[model samples]
Target: MTVSRALSKPELVSEETRNRIEQAVRELGYVPNLAASALVTRRSGVVGALITTITNPILATTIEILQQGLSKAGLHMLIGETRFSPEEETKMLRAFLGRQLDGLILAYGYHTPETLALLQAARIPVVELWDLPEGDEPRTPVGQVVGFSNWAAGAAAGQHLVDCGYQRPAFFGYEDARENLRWQGFRQAVVEGLGIEPLRYNTSAIPHIDDGVAVIERYVRGELEFDGAFFTNDMPAIGALFTCQRNGIDVPGELGICGFGDLPIARVASPALTSVRVPAELVANTTVELLTQQIKAEGVGAMLNDVGSELIARESTARRSS
Candidate 1:
């Protein structure tokens, strides 16, 4: 026990005892088996996170920040991508359970019925990212939540588009619960502000630069008539902007674009992007803090944090067409 104290919690053991333990470990060439130790201690020193996508730059940064925060707390992160599938998320979560992870983090607060059931039974410390909790539904098994309001962020983007005087605002993206919330919010705002339902180009494909380029290319070919649009995130907005330039359609003059996430590249892109800035870093740091607290707390402390978001108006949406 003293040897374990010396190795795991060095400050808890006296220097004299630690020195002897170190010498013994060296003389015996004893490599402490973490697997064996975990059985007794019930701490694997690893936290797992399930995400929808690994390719999204915004989510990628959030995961990086989360890893750093967990590392400081003496825990390593294990990440799993679900490719936006509830079944895949459930499978990954089951794998994490098998590893006996210290805690779990989920990208989305919502989950499949089976996933919610498993988490409810496992009783593991869990913190879901990207969206705030809707309720304590019998189906909602998440303990802590740290993220922004997807609906509100979307509404803000739509409202901004209306303010910028884009006559016909359109939304472009794929559908999932979270993204659909954004779409609903954007739709609500655009409809209320402009008294017209915004156009929607929904797809089953994942959001990508190529998809965006193709949308703009169609418009350039005189196929699509949307003069202004809001993309699910930055990729498509930038793609559209690029195509507009190639076709000589002036941004804000003939076309307006807005996106979410406010990725770093958005600020520097030609014509600059107007976007809804999600508090990704804050969410990551808070999720770590809340998750660590829940793991170590006497009572599985619960938190539902909404860091909120802001809409950044820029050149892309600066025009007020007369």
Candidate 2:
């Protein structure tokens, strides 16, 4: 009807004529080619996802959920891995823009200004997840932001320890901004919030179970007195948990341990771990939903969706008597 202009010229052609033309086209089975349609419409039906490191299991899990969510919405996900470098991330963003994707998602919260400008030029939806900086900034409705506050999770761990009557506590994690944020929050809560300065330790890189064992050994052998411990992520926490078990040190009874990103094994450990529960799958689903909305120009406003996380109580860290 639009092609024939019959609606405009109803007097020129009868309704019967318009209906006949529609019926004939439907019978012939003419399908519009998306490539040809894109030439005029300028839509690729593709979303770009940039992860900090593809090798990291945590990030891999997040991306897996994101891909499934995008696929269900009939959108394709284009993935790029930047090894925690700003320059490399910019290059990846440019490459994605070259493909003319509808939206972009970055796993690392940090992005260079140049890349931000380039994304702005592309005028597509952009999302940053997993440790966004805390500040007063405008929400990117044109894009979207979805994830939890690392600072809050850290504070929660600190408060849990305080509530459990652990006076002396220690913080252990990598020396990155994400880890730092958690440490900062933990510091504030444990020191200023609860009026006790917790001993802080930083690792050069991602702390594995071996690293956890080493830290605990150093503390125990060096006479570092601590009643509780908080780890950056579950890997190191679990590491320390087993290390304590093997050393014949009682958990909660002797030293309380709390971890972040309550992984699956947190509950399965000999003494279940008490840690912050980050909904990895929820982050993935929301990222895809925001991207799909951006692609469709659905006018969904700037998404600063803060999915609330919970603290799972397990045996790894239990309250102690004063």
Highest TM-score: which candidate?
A: 1
Q: What does candidate 1's lDDT look like per residue over 179-224, in tens digits?
A: 7788888999999998998888874456787777888887878877
Report every candidate's CA lDDT.
0.84, 0.77
Tens-digit lDDT string for candidate 2 (1-322): 4544552344567678878766876998855465665566687777888887775566779988888888777677888878777789999888888877877888876667897789778877787786654734522332466777878888888888888888888898877666777787888889865687898887546546776787778777975678789987778888889889888889989888988777778878888999898888887877777777767778775558787677887786677865
What global local distance difference test value does model 2 have? 0.77
lDDT of 2 at 251: 92
lDDT of 1 at 43: 91
Write down the worst ten-residue block by lDDT for model 1.
133-142
Clashing pairs in 1: none
Please give the clash total of every predicted structure, in order.
0, 2
Q: Tell me, by lDDT, which candidate is best.
A: 1
